[model samples]
Target chain A: MSGREEILGRVREALSVPSHAGVKAVSGEGVRDVRKARGFLPDGGATPEARLKKFRKLAAKLKAEVEVLPDLAAAGAFLADLAKTEGWRQIASHRNDLTNSVLTSLKVPILWTDDEPGTADLEQVEAGVTSCEALIAQTGSVFVTGKGCGGRALSVLPPHHVVIATLDQLLPDMLAAFDLLRERYGDNPPSFVSFITGASRTGDIERILVLGAHGPKRLTILIVGN
Target chain B: MTSDTPAHQFQEDSAVSTADFEHRQWMQDALHGYENTRGGTEAMFGDFEQARQTAAAIKWEAIENLDTLLGEFADKLEARGTRVFWAGNGKEAVDYILGVCKEHGAKNIIKSKCMTTEEIHLNPALEAAGMQVVESDLGEYIVQLREEPPFHFVFPAMHLKRDRISQIFEEKLGTEPSSDPEELTMIARRVMRQKYCEADIGISGANFAVADSGMISITENEGNARLTTSLPKVHIAVLGIEKVVPKLEDLSVMLQMLGTAGTGQWLTAYNSMIGGPRQPGEVDGPEEFHVVLLDNHRTKLLADPEQRDALRCIRCGACLNVCPIFKNIGGHNYGTTYQGPIGSVITPHLRGLQSYKHLSFSSSLCGACSETCPVKIDLHHHLMRNRRNAVQEKGGKMERWMFGQFAKVMTHPKRYRGSEGLMRFGAKLWLPFKGRKLDPLKAWTASRDLPAPAPKSFMKQWQAQEREQEEGKS
Candidate 1:
């Protein structure tokens, strides 16, 4: 018999003896109700201000550069000032409402993701600037998708990663982020859905923290809000 | 030495490791740092113990209905144009991966950290097939360059100091010695930049397989996995059959707990879910995506309900961090793909009871493993239970025989009195040889003095007391 048949047969035989101590499993669709279990997870705050405050707090702890600007105009000014200080020659980004509004302020050469940019060229750029789907407050994570956030590699390949997001994009926690994903693209989801938490890091050598192992070393999130 | 058994190998290696105070201190210091950070991070949870219960229940649900969830996971993956292969053992899994490499005429392969691949010894097989495999994770890469298996499952090169790591790089890569972690990381990052672009296939291991969403989730502190999957034309994920969870949203509960428990972070740097090859409109990803489901004695573990909960292991290394035995003996001494308390409990079932039962017996039965386990496997009890199972299976004959003799002497009054006298005589005679080479209690007495046995038996003393009382009454 094939591996599938033999393995399934073995599993069926093994599970015949009922041993679960009354852990009720939702039959049919087989997706157990997780709403109750989510309560056990760290609670994101109830109000928007509390969530925003929590996001900044976590971002600071992770050593990520989080700038909460009053509006997009102020964000653009901040980016322009950052561009000058970092001495950036070019920025890699994909065209979107967020990117379109902010690109003019950088006043630097742009490497567009949609233009079929070479991988080597993408590597040499100063930073990859993209718009994220949501900013998760509970873990201080940015949710990105292949189709939405300039494909899979753009946000990760460059040395520095800059995420431009609006206040409305901030979600309370991971569950809300997952719910937003299901609502946006349920059946035919994007090929890659990622939660980018803080900068790329490693503690592999004598358990010492080293930033920018293979991905971006610096992750700057600009949240434009009131 | 003539025995040449794994049990003997474990003993010899353990002796070497435990005596090396420098090595033991390194392990203890690393774990001490882990404990302090993990304590605070765990407190960030709304209810840490409650979170553990929920994680355990979800894993329990996943394992109990393994067949259905696995089928659903496969069906959904296949629906999205991903090829699915089932391998009953490690050899089959390796064969399937080799066939994929051959079909693509692959040259260089880039791999992220995957303990499942290590479990199957995938790299050696691939290299023997003439494919160059480069480990991308910093620790795995360091250990790979040193031509050794990972020292710890998570911290693959945890045993090596920075100077030692620099020495390895100098010997292998003709690079200058540098002790700074940032410089060493840059050295690897610089070297692998071209390999990711040139590699034909990328192999990864999934932390959880979401059956409902047809996606496999990978958690990593570094972005090696992200680059591995994104750049390569063919992405293959090999996961154990027991990794299946019911829904994608279940990650909402599992991911944060995994990050905190595994590395003492609120969350790891990147958590990615890949459902299939790149879609029609998507800009980049692998052209072909393959998912290999490996059973490899997991069904044997599942068949025994008493030990079945062990399959819920998330490979978080939390149990290892808390285990006193692991800290003392270290990882390589266990001689298994996994090490520490979890390895001891499950190795007997995964490998064989008679051969690996020594691992189970080596533990101090402190129950620290059970308490530290996030998925809540009864680890210490399982270790004890493995002892019973090993004996019942006609193993541990020497122990059983000795106990049988003990039971016989205790049952008869004459034999008890006679043996008691003999023991006292023996104790007196044994005093000179206590810590000598000829001593039976030499191993115990070598470190410290053993309390001397009483000069007279309890029965004789009691009889004398009764005689004196009778005289007093008269």
Candidate 2:
């Protein structure tokens, strides 16, 4: 059966099951009742356009926050310049062509032959740049599939992270992205699919969004257009 | 920080008021966190409808032919020299895992974030058996330190304020007072790193188990997961039966969605595909590898097609983040391993409908969970169905009578019409004695003012309008 059919059938069966008989059962099933009680109602209005409007507004707000680079080469240049300005001697890049070429062009001494940044002399490197498999324009997020980009440390260890992505890789929303992901990776996608919105940010310290927590502080995105 | 503290008391409370209050707080915090994550996630789901359609088709096709595919997958995994154990439920699953730990003499066990383990309450079981289990994932580790269950599925510690974390780190790890997130993560990393290396056995939950090559896939941003599986001498992977897909190609498709949807990452840093024990040419891998295929209520979930969509969940916290109820109460207030919309539906199934019957009432019938689900699980619908089931199958005598009276009053126009006058009379009568508030309506009045009942019902007013129109026309 199709997914919709399968799901619909289950819903029908669930509805056919009995509801509580009286007040005590309702009170006894308090939290659970509230949860289950809040399902779709026939009288409930249709999906609201205001919700979509809010989503659009939020997306626009995020786009404003993230600096969108024009192309891959431009992004590479930006990263190369960032390293140059910082006066860093050593750097790390994943073994992918775009990453390797960018690093080579910059003429920085490369460490950690493997793609993972953790293996590199993290203390020595000022920045790390890797190619992203997907770029989320909605939140200015970039994903680094572990397959091509080495390991988690590449983004985590470096003080600064420069992620490179083509605009074609951008997905509209989480739902749409999953569909594409399934198409490419199937049931067993890569071991890790990092959904990075901005720099490694965490508010766990002081209820403040402290960027550069166990990961990069300065996240530079290079959005390559089609 | 003290045992006698309000925080401690709150945690210990079994009362509904305290639980509701705490649950509300959790939901708010989670919603904010979700807001932060959603921005980046949306960008990754560029053509969301197309992606979902494709994913649903792939998943449906796979499930339809799951039997044959599972057989093929079993053959391949066995060929790779990994022992696969099929457990019927939480008890059996935990037993099989503990058995592995015992066979290997594993004293120290390090684990990545696995909801299945949480569903089974495996840590207490392992510790009871005299084994030490450490959560290696950053969020899991933080929650473990707090001695709290996950508040959010993807970001288990999302409900925790940074101050709480700083306090926990100071108390548990004796860290310096640094509320900086970076500094805090460094502390967690330094602590978990040691656990990862010292671990005798490693356990993880698979995002997907590829039947074609018999490969178990683990996706994560933290290196701890990879370290846990790779550094340990023996590796044990516990996964749900519904996690299986027929081929590597199909597995890839699901991962695409899971990776982006779960955390808004295009892909996580590590996607480790383990094929049994270390092969001839492999440099680093576990000496022994075992796979436990957990069936716990999944076959039953599959039997009922609608509920099976719950199985399609990739443990993404998107729904929880968007859920107003989850934001308010937090994960712990639910008093179950799973939290939020998905948790409400799944908990009743996993633990039995009787124990967690109240969980269904925690929601406001919001369809946010359905909108956010990566696999399109109709969490809202299931929640409603759960309510119906509770009333029909598990309701008490008082509940049945009250609802029956309500149904009768609602169905009868004359009785309903007369009830309006009674409400007004009652309101006026109680107003004098209410002393600025009605005692019976205290809960309702606390958050909102009670509207006075109308003199006439809407149905009655509509009938009057029809009569007036007919007379005017004549």
* CA-lDDT, candidates in order: 0.89, 0.63
After the best TM-score superposition of candidate 1, give how far the Cα of residue B119 lies from its true spot, in angstroms: 1.2
DockQ of each: 0.60, 0.07
What lDDT tens digits, residue by residue, belong to model 2 across residues A73-144? 666677667777988788776676767655566767876536223332553587776787765433334556
Fnat by candidate, in order: 0.74, 0.06
- Please give, for residues B45-82, the per-residue lDDT of candidate 2 as tens digits: 43554555455555554555555555666677777677
Error of 1 at B314 (Å): 0.8
- Cα misplacement distance, residue B429 of candidate 2 (Å): 5.4
What is the lDDT for A5 in model 2? 38
Clashes of each: 0, 96
Number of the predicted model whose TM-score against the real structure is largest: 1
The 10-residue segment with the lowest total lDDT in model 1 chain A: A22-31
Q: Specify the CAPRI tier of model 1.
A: medium
